[model samples]
Target: RLEPGGLTFTLADGAFGLGGARTPLDAPLRGRITVEGKDLEGLVAVAMGPEPRLGGGLKATFSLAGTAGRPVLTGEVALANVTVTETNPQCPEPRRRTLALPSVTLAAGWEDGRFTGRPLMASVAGGTVTATVIAQVDRRITVQLGDLAIRALPLERVLVDFLCHAQAVSGPLDLTGTAAFTAGDIPRTLSGAGQVKIGAGRIVGVQALRMLDAIASVAGAVGTLLGPGTPVSSSALAEFDSITGTYQARDGVLTSRDLVFNGRAVKATIAGQYNLASGALSFDVVAAVAGRNVRARVTGTAAAPSVSVVPASLLSPGDAGRIEKGLQDLLKRMR
Candidate 1:
């Protein structure tokens, strides 16, 4: 109802707001909005297009002030039983699956064309996701994520269900990173640096593991003398005790120099670049076993990578010497 004091209106779902401005667009505005258990899907669609389908109940209490042209809003929003589904062709199968986020709470504000959500927290698959989001809407929308931390997040939920990637790794994942990307093209313009750790897992379809498996096949002659318990195998999967890495991404290219994969029988280090836009891989994997290194060059796309052991002719003098010494030691043990 419009009165001399201001305007007070009640929405369909018992949502209510009161504004204290003489004119609807005048300055010195004072308003408070309370919405309870409203459908989040409609709100999300209105704010962020209709691509990612969201389902949830949203509860919020916001204080609104400032002029119409540059309105300021501060609020606390809570979402319950949220499920989000979107298209991701990169996944192995069922390219679209719903991700259930049990709870999400945000301490947020908006001023002018910018939205800031500090300490946005979500509960996903028995883990916690925390991040600070800063989004600015101007000529093009830009989002900056700060203090992002994902603790013990399940790989199946993110990589398989959400991201839709063919590669499989099962474990609790811990990651801390900060990233900035454009709203429409995150894969093309994303830039970030982070450290990631996956605890006690089995990895398959990873290029490094593929290289290690190939190296074992090439050394099958030695494996025959070592007996059936030898680590040599053509199987493309590995049980890793832990995989830890620090990574940096710039303009859709990810580069790492010290990614270490620790397995019970073999350990490997990866150093190189992977192009996110084209899924091209250009990396070197060095698997260490019995104090010797089996080096391989990794190339091709992420979907189908090729690994070839680096010939002794391509190795440095020190690497060649180490390989030769390792062979001599193995022969002595056989005698």
Candidate 2:
């Protein structure tokens, strides 16, 4: 069995341990770990077998320290075909999710009351998930993710579970992009914003095509979604290339660029901001989508993000009005 102490127990060479059930790493991990401290210290390692093609083994060193009432964790974790799961007591039912992990490799450093690291992803399937993250113990969490590849993913199913952690319905989502998350303390807020460039893949109710072909007529509708139908055509193969977007994080709020459905041609951009903090995190954004003049001006606060759609008539021929309104609303909402 292994326990939560300052030790690294492994079986590669006789044995290595860091306190949890006392079982070694190379052997099947059927052990238990327990730690009770505002401050923690420990080292962990997994034994390596003989074959190089098999795996490289794993090792990690970590510690939790605090000063002036602020706490921080420092560590490094490396692994192959390993699982990183949080052992919280709240998981009474076995249905709990471990945030499934395959290969684990990370080199991290923590200080100034935060937890930071450089983590990489070896594989993912649904595109509905993200893992590599840097957390600030006292404040926020920053994460960057690559694109995803899913098949026949139900948009509604993915949306519910993703937004509320509810039961996951059966469907696949193939997505690719970067994301950032911020966890709030009071009122228990959660902020997340990211952009994805989805390549060609089957979606439950989505049309498939090449991305670049869709962006040809974006200029036609650069003001409002209710404007004249976009005037563009594309033949995106849904294979090469991807959509692009921006994600921002401030305090515990998240803001995202519009979802450019295609490569700027047949879809309108959807930008929004949310605050998972104390008060409210509301914000707005504006951009042309699907060659339609669509945009919105929104504002709120880091604690309360908001959004407001800008009518097409108020937009300038060049769509500059929509852009200005978006920024203006963003600042005003913060008030």
Candidate 3:
């Protein structure tokens, strides 16, 4: 029926291209197989599964079979980044679906029987998403994330060069988490810790000031006026709160923070259990920004371990002035 797990024909002569050419999204397939790589070890194994369902018209499955020493094991599947728009003129700007991708030529690698380099070279909503991974091949597998790049690269790949320190500000945003399966369990238990490398890929100076609001007092303070002479409302100098929140997850854990918008720094954590058999998302996340101590309790499952933030402080107003000027000057060196 098939060659010794390498690549061969299955049934019809139309060349079904089973193993290597298939992806994880295409599950339980039975077709022809043929792969052309460097060596046999590099391409550990090949398989197919059901097409996974994401947010939009994202329908695709993935096939995995490789190790870190080998890199990639599966083949590339065709992807479509298409947007739908209604052509009617009078219908309130018509219905539009957006699909943004920055670069072309997308592919993935394999590390220890797991998939690597997924959702690469794509941009959406001004923020980027990508992953870096290192997986172990076994009956009970354990996978570790080298990095998770939100604004630049993928999350799994970023773990290699970054660390999970909640209070430090270096990289723009960092995501650190893990996945593991114990012995003799019906399913697997996946969970890990999270934190961020603050100020990594911020755009402007006001962004930095807002981040510090959670730990320190901002220099510029403005208020809104009324009765024909109200200050144009452009002045965002009012004191705000910090970002301190928590969450509990189901399939995994999810912790989120809205620090950049609130004019302050923040700290959030998401951790808990996720039952795949049941559709449940629970978590615990924390956020603290602008001298405001806060903890937001959430019950949603966002499976990845996250980055945490540490509190920051300055001595006095004079110290703040020096720090501010010095920080502005240091911007040249920080980024």
List model 2 lDDT by residue over 1-335, tens digit each.
24333334433222233355333332322222222221112222223222111222356655543332333345566554533333333334553334323454555655664555455444432333334555555434433333322333343333332222211112334444444444324223433444444453322212122212323333333423324553544432222233346565554565675544343233445566555444343434344444335455545542223335555533458667657777788799999
The TM-scores, one per candidate, come to 0.79, 0.37, 0.30
TM-score of 3: 0.30
Please give, for residues 81-185, the per-residue lDDT of candidate 3 as tens digits: 422222232223322222334322235555446655444444533446554554565775455544444453322222211222122222334333333333233
Candidate 2's C-alpha runs over 4 A off are: 4-76, 80-98, 107-122, 126-243, 256-259, 263-266, 277-335
CA lDDT of each candidate?
0.75, 0.40, 0.34
lDDT of 1 by residue, 256-303 (tens): 999998876678898999888888989898776433576778898887
Off by over 4 Å in 3: 1-114, 118-121, 134-145, 152-190, 197-251, 254-335
Looking at candidate 3, the ten consecutive residues that score lowest on lDDT are 218-227
**All predictions: root-mean-square deviation over Cα?**
6.6, 15.4, 16.5
Q: Score residue 239 of candidate 2 by CA lDDT.
A: 26
Looking at model 2, residue 329 earns an lDDT score of 82
Q: Which candidate has the highest lDDT of all?
A: 1
Give the local distance difference test score of model 1: 0.75
Of candidate 2, the 10-residue stretch with the lowest lDDT total is: 203-212
